[model samples]
Target chain A: MKKLLDDPAQAVTDSLRGFGLAHADQISVHTEPNFVTRAGGTPAGQVAVISGGGSGHEPLHAGFVGAGMLDAAVPGEVFTSPTPDQVLAAVQAADAGAGVLLIVKNYTGDVLNFETAAELAEAEGIEVASVLVNDDVAVEDSLYTAGRRGVAGTLVVEKVAGAAAARGASLAEVAALAERVVAGVRSMGVALTACTVPHVGRPSFDLADDEVEIGIGIHGEPGRQRVQAAGASDITRRLVDSVLDDIDLAAGARVLLFVNGMGGTPASELYVVYGVARQMLADQGVEVVRSLVGSYVTSLEMQGVSVTVAVLDDELLELWDAPVRTPALTW
Target chain B: MKKLLDDPAQAVTDSLRGFGLAHADQISVHTEPNFVTRAGGTPAGQVAVISGGGSGHEPLHAGFVGAGMLDAAVPGEVFTSPTPDQVLAAVQAADAGAGVLLIVKNYTGDVLNFETAAELAEAEGIEVASVLVNDDVAVEDSLYTAGRRGVAGTLVVEKVAGAAAARGASLAEVAALAERVVAGVRSMGVALTACTVPHVGRPSFDLADDEVEIGIGIHGEPGRQRVQAAGASDITRRLVDSVLDDIDLAAGARVLLFVNGMGGTPASELYVVYGVARQMLADQGVEVVRSLVGSYVTSLEMQGVSVTVAVLDDELLELWDAPVRTPALTW
Candidate 1:
């Protein structure tokens, strides 16, 4: 594989440095502990939005910290959630007296560490709230497991609640908005090939050229099933149908449609999927009020796409339409 | 070549259908004519924001259609611009009684088609204005055979101007703001590997495993030169410095930085780039006001990153901070 870098081991460090230098105004080196946050000093009475997970998903937590998104995003190594101590520091750094909201995906390690930090923050009078994001419809819940893993849908919650926070909506309002976004959104994905984690240095999954895994998670977790590769129209229909089946979207209810590239699918292909997706909905008498198609949320160079839809109401629409300026998301 | 598809020809069409089905509420299908617009119908007398280009840049023209962004977008095939007719129709669809502003990249086909449509709109008595985005510093001259192609910086123009438009700013105001965004923004890129342009069944360029191409265009265009593959930090610094040198960024001036993935790169490396990038900028006394790091704009799976910095003033910053609701971008 051809790449522009010296040592693979140093690749992550190199990228972080570049991120800091590029955004020296909004972000800086929080070295003693590590993370990226607004360089212009934290504001008081603001609910600190602290979220972190793996490093491979750029513009997620870190790229989101700005006017209307996240206050601080603690990016861990690729596909690895930050440790408890790191989460704790991020929470502390983002704290501006109004308390912080910990946005943690429902992954095992991420949830556990963040929940513990929430408790610790509460003990320290920081007052923290967390609404676990489990928008992935492909996952099955086991009583022993940490529930559904958060996927691309976290972006919806972050943007919605982040907007609410930016509007000076109370913490309750922000938390409530986040929950509504979580409740309304559903996502499902498929993978044509397993992506090799950077450190692992090998293919994550060994699928044959002719096979494609349906309903796969972003982290290379097992998919719902493997199937023969189908046409874009067929695949697009299946993915959207699966997600809609997971949630009973009212026939006339407005929705915000998102066809996310799982890192590798190109925009052209995504547009093709969008074409089919638009037709399928019309065939079903559903009226899409709004739409989003792109790599807004992504997996690391995974060759596939995920379909996400959020049932929208007036309030949700307002929040969705709100202005925001962040590194990953703009406008 | 582990793509999950029966054939490549139907990729774009199928994807669009799937996209429609998923967000059936907010958007409707444009069968006879391709293109999706707002559900409530384009308001009369509202200045419509219209943008389109080639297809692979997903979530760009299409996803960014809503209250604060684009009114409608026309999508073409991958890496190929839409026909003059398609663009004209979208302009018609998006045009409320007020008129329309065409936000076009500096690509030859896009500019030509959009320019033609502007004439057609004037014939229809519909007011039209345009801002040519030529933010790529790599492609220096505004006058060239292949002039500076628009890159991720287009998103900023869209967002900033979209905000101004949403705030009831006049067509002149919106057009002027967009030009300012285009003027303030500058981007440069480097590619590590050539991308496969599906139809060609070959790579756009060939780079030795240890070599990197700097100042490359998103559409697999050649760059300034090729050098040995250096660390991500080194490459990012060079990319940043290259842009800085071309534009004399005032010391202590606040700027919005963007580090974008050229399709195939992983975020793990992006963070490393950010870290070093932050330190370097601080050392230069350049303040990174706001930053966006992600795959906002991308080539078809090219392994590299492009750096974009938009010089920000108070008004521009406010406009940047304004809320926008589009499929690809949300605040």
Candidate 2:
């Protein structure tokens, strides 16, 4: 594959090493545990927030680590879950006098390892709470997930929860906020093309030139169905309708609409999707309070787009507006 | 060819309509002249900064319209320069009591149209100045450019110049700062594969499975040379070496390193490039004071990366660090 990599096996570690130095002003890298923590450390009395998953979805867990977002991010290999020991190290390093909160995505491997780490942290007399993010409405079952896979909505969760923690909320309060955000958020993705993992050295799947996969998972897992490729508005309608059907919004409800590119998609297209989504939402009388259009959480070089809508209340909106200073996102 | 667009001919206007609606909070769109201006007009006495070019480079001219960036942005069709009338409209709309400044890239069409707009604005008794950015070190002359095609460095120019204008600098001061930024900045890009325009319905160019286009232009035009694919470090080294060779740095010089993805590359890979770039700069005793890694200026869905190095003096560095509140960039 013509990827900008050295060795497939050493990609993760080498990337992290580079990541740490590139963002050294904002974070510190711990190679032994393979985690990134805020450079200045979390406040003494503020709850520490941590998250992680496979490595390929960049700027997710690691790029979100900073003063207002994540306290620490533990990274695994491209599509592999981080070991429990790695998660434990992140928890121990991030925990101050306040308790720790683990934001785990709803994947089987990630769930097991994070849960085990939570138990280990508790055994060490450190209070820990976990929130599982399962906001992707794309599929109910996948090769690596049980119910639904966590997708871009995890970004919304981390932002809101991290804001709560930054505001000196308790561990229970932060975890509760994360779960509340997850409950109100729904995401669905459509892939125009498959992605090639460096190690795999080939595309994850193949499709006819005129075909596309609707509601595809972030890992390139099968979606609801394949169909003839359509225009931006049509594809956006499918994703937006699926989300609107899954969630109930009052006539004048507000939401933070996030139109995310699946790695290789351009911002021009994302804005097109956002434009179509905004018109659709207006037709349905759902107001878009705030919107983000770009690649926040992405698969590696997958050509597609994912739309996540989080129904927002005043409190949630306030938290989202709070200043966040991360490498991937900053305000 | 799969693309998230409606009619290929109407793609530019449609995307702009969507963009205006999505960012209505920050900017307003005018169709007659075809430009996006600040929703809240510029301050009465502040120098009004404006920039524009062909569309498809999202977050460039349009997305950069905000409080601390451009006062207006004019757009043309995909890879086609905006008409003189369009540029004149933006100049008229954004001109405060003080004056107006236009930032034009080095492409021939962009330069001619913007220069004509300046003459028109001056005829109307509005003070105006223009700066032409030609920072790409890839090729001296190309299909669309006379000398070098302005690429990602235009973002730096707009940002620094925007900050200066926001500080109430005169049009002359703002234009001078922009010229200084262009003088110190150098950039080069490499493309792994070609992009397919919606209307074209085919790849812009073809590449064998194992080959890559080195020093490729943002429009997929030819670069310095083509070679077999290389590793990230080796590719980065070639780019960095070319830039270093073109510019001379003092023993303890500082620079701003911007590693931009050409729409389709991932952050993980960019960070890997940044790592190698930082080490190489350190080896040369050039310290990096600031760094930005993401897709800022881009070709639509082109799978590539571009490296830009701007040798910064204290004044330029301060202007860069100054707060910016654009849709695509914020400090």
Candidate 3:
């Protein structure tokens, strides 16, 4: 696959430069590299929430940085986890006197690297806590891999804890909030098209035009299964059904619904999904108190969508009600 | 062009359903037809901020509904403007006591329709104000074709104004703040691939693998001109330079920079662009106080990036700092 680039390795740096040029008022690039933060300010006495991973998902780590969300975000190359050193640097930069918490999606490399970075930060006297978001209900109780591969559900945990941290919640409180969000949330996705990582220059996988893969991880990694393309309403049901079954967001529970595009599906389709999903939830006696429909979290350019449900409580709802300003999801 | 769908007309509604399902908590279908909001319990009196356009851009109009941002967002079919009635209904739902402000991107159809809606709202005794965002430097500043097409910069205006409104700033205040963001922001983009609108089922334009369309619009419209595809470093420079020259974010001035993906470029490339932009701004002694990088707004699946700069002031900064919890950007 041909792509516009000087060098594949330099792609991330170049992309960050473009990002800096466009949103320089809300964020700043750290001198220590790969670390970005809200312009000129650090969270004070609040848990400095930090998260990072492979670079492909735009706005996830970086766009999430601001007052109500992540204090700092570090991005590695496409599909490659941020190095331990990068994670350590982000933690150091975001750390106020309060401490820093790393929200790691449950990917092996990310977990290992962030854990290593936490140790390094601890060595430097920076109080660091780690919260793993393993909310993807798609990855079954596996014999091999970890439980579920975290996909779009990371955004929910990030926002919930980010809101708490923004409210001056302590590191422990923020960590607990994050863990609760992870526990309450469940996500599942399908991809209609395989993404072409610029460096690779080809589709990650090959499927006929009518086929879509279910349980797709963001990176186009081989998913749990492939299925014939179905209608959007049907797809939403399937995704939500899996998530509902996984988390048992029982009848009458207050839920936060997120119909997230895996990057490619348009808002037009997402909106349609919303109507069907609302009806489905209502039929199940689940009350959706709030909903987010869009590409807040995404897989590259995969033409599919994911369903994320967060069983909410008063506290979680309050946290959710807190304001946030990120580049992607702003209120 | 190949796509995963049964029929073209069903794409938008179908997608909306899926979107609603995902973010069911903070959003819900505006049962009165084509609008969406945070699941339930509309926070009344907040200056109802409604933004909409064609459907391709996800997490833009709809994903941005919650406490601090838009009260409702309506989506049209793929690349098709929402009808006036849809806008009117959204305005009605959002108008509590304070009134409603329309944040319209400068596309001709959107402007005309939103303008009509504003009139309808005023007739209904709901105070209404509107700020048209025309920040795309790529479009020729001719008396021709209504003003310059509002590109990704619309997001900035919506966020600042939405935040102001969420804080109980009146319609006038929100409108004025929207203008401030509009005045300070400028964006220019280049696309490597011609996006295909779903209904159209064909590429909007033909761009060879090594060709780039500079000055692209948000609707997959052809850019000002077609040129050979260049490296990310070079493309970043061109787009950023266009924005910088269009608006003099003078040396030593702190500005918010936004590098928006036209919906296709990988975040890896975005980071690289961010780095180049950082150094470029430094070279001119322009201090980037805040930065936003990602596909905050998009033009379907075009491999392109737009650079938007919002020159910040004290008031804009506070407005930017206000708390907001929307599906797309929360803080």
Candidate 4:
């Protein structure tokens, strides 16, 4: 309830205006359609990469738009999916002669809307491909998702796929690379506190001071279990175990590790979690090839952390290391 | 206090272990003296830049250690100043016979400890120069200091000064550039709620359900005043006005605007503040040459925002745009 905002209804639109101004050198905003496209128009023969979901997850889709990442990002209201029309506008704005790729999270509404948008774009003779990111290992099914929740790994997908697109990959090649990245990655999260949607004016869930939710989704949906709060090491072990269980990796497998913060968690704690998780992976004889630690996908003010591990091959590692100039994931 | 940590006493050291492991390619950790130094040592003739302070304001000193930034960082216990021995160790590790520059915040404890360290280093024949950043316009003095508290502007100092040092500036030159950056910058912040230090296990201060602390310090130190909670625009106006008053700017002045989140606030809200801040600056006819909107300097889980504006000339602007590969501020 203590959020900084003028009106809850205006939060998404107003924030986008701010994003446009702050990153004017790298992005342009389409006010009417509520999408952000690359400031410089797409190259004539490079595949356009577009991604979006709800707005509360900062720097996910919007902040990732730039030279080596997303071409366009269409954000909806906080925790609400964008309409098909909005997604179509983003596609049209980002499309050059090459093609367009829609990077959709596995959320039911997001999948439906983005599919509709892809169909609309195809009808207009714009070649398009689509991929779903369902890397969250938290639950088999969730309140708003059909199969699995797309959590922090969406960022991994966007980064690798964006790099591929930037390298002039065709629509089919970019979508295939995105799917491979999705299949190779798994993520799990835990929340010590629930987040309040600005419009709701209350936390989405209630928990006692000493309780914690393990395997939680980004939207405060119930995870696999809620238990008494544990220390950073124990919590990290649980999330890492969950992710490791879902992924197939041999001993000595090199992987990329991502430790994502759930908004309110400080970087110090995230590092603590990272230390524990890295130790855990080392114990399992898996080599961490690369690591990213920070708030990439966040649930608004939820205090927690998510651990993601993406099995990395030489090609995938090369793509991950490829220069990215997005606001959040530049390197 | 609900923090993600195994032991409150070991938080700082344990977190650094993770930082070292995660950024092993770029940094190396010295556990005994408790400092992080660049894994790839400083260039033979490059002046080494080092910074440090309390542990909780993460990604400040530690995350800024790498190429084009701090050569070393010494972290103390949470909200506590590091010992002179620790700072001296960092200075020694980073010193490559070219000299060393210590960037200290304006907190009394930090200044005292860093000064002691400088004397220690000089006695060891390492030429040392120190610069104090006190750019907070919140008050003339605060709970922990005799003068203005160094807040978000410290990042600007580290960035520009570190760039100068990377360019092989002499110790005197780096120190002078850091001082100039401090003089050119002013910042103000507001806290929506008090933060709980893990060891303290309680909120630092109390506020009513509908109250806010204006001009708040990063350590939750008392600021100018508290008042009934206001909308983001009104609050942004108050903070922007305070910073604007303390700095000299003509109508056509070009400045770099930084809107930082104090840990728990979501990026959406930070952008709201940024949008308002950018508009206010434009209304005053000040052109924003560059803008950084994120949680660069943060209080631990305190919900709030801080605004900083640094007057920029061609030299400072060029340095600001120089490539930086720190863990946090990479571009």
The digit string of per-residue lDDT tens for model 3 on A26-91 reads: 777664468788886675677888888887777687888887888899888788899999998888
How does each model score on lDDT? 0.75, 0.90, 0.77, 0.91
- For candidate 2, report its TM-score: 0.99
Give the TM-score of each candidate. 0.75, 0.99, 0.77, 0.99
Q: Which prediction has more favorable DockQ, 2 or 4?
A: 4
Candidate 3 CAPRI level: acceptable
Number of the predicted model whose lDDT against the real structure is largest: 4
**By DockQ, is 1 or 2 better?**
2
DockQ of each: 0.36, 0.75, 0.35, 0.85
The clash count for each model shown is 81, 0, 99, 0
Q: What is the per-residue lDDT of model 1 for residues B254-331, given as tens digits with 9 covering 90 to 100?
A: 888777778777765555666656667778888888877666687777778888889888989999888766555666
Per-residue lDDT of model 4, residues B133-175, tens digit only: 8989988878889899998999999989889988888888888
Please rank every candidate by TM-score, starting with the best. Answer: 4, 2, 3, 1
**After TM-score superposition, what is the CA distance of residue A206 in candidate 1 from its true location, in Å?**
3.3
First chain TM-score, candidate 2? 0.99
DockQ, cand. 2? 0.75
Ranking by lDDT: 4, 2, 3, 1
Per-residue lDDT for B1-331 in model 3, tens only?
A: 4443446777766666556665666778754367886566456656778788877887677877877777788887777789999999888777778888888887778888898888988898989888888898887643223778887888878778778887788888889889988888888888777778877878887878777888888776656778777676688788888887888666778777777777766655665667776778788888776666666687777777788778888888777767766655655
- Among these predictions, the greatest DockQ belongs to 4
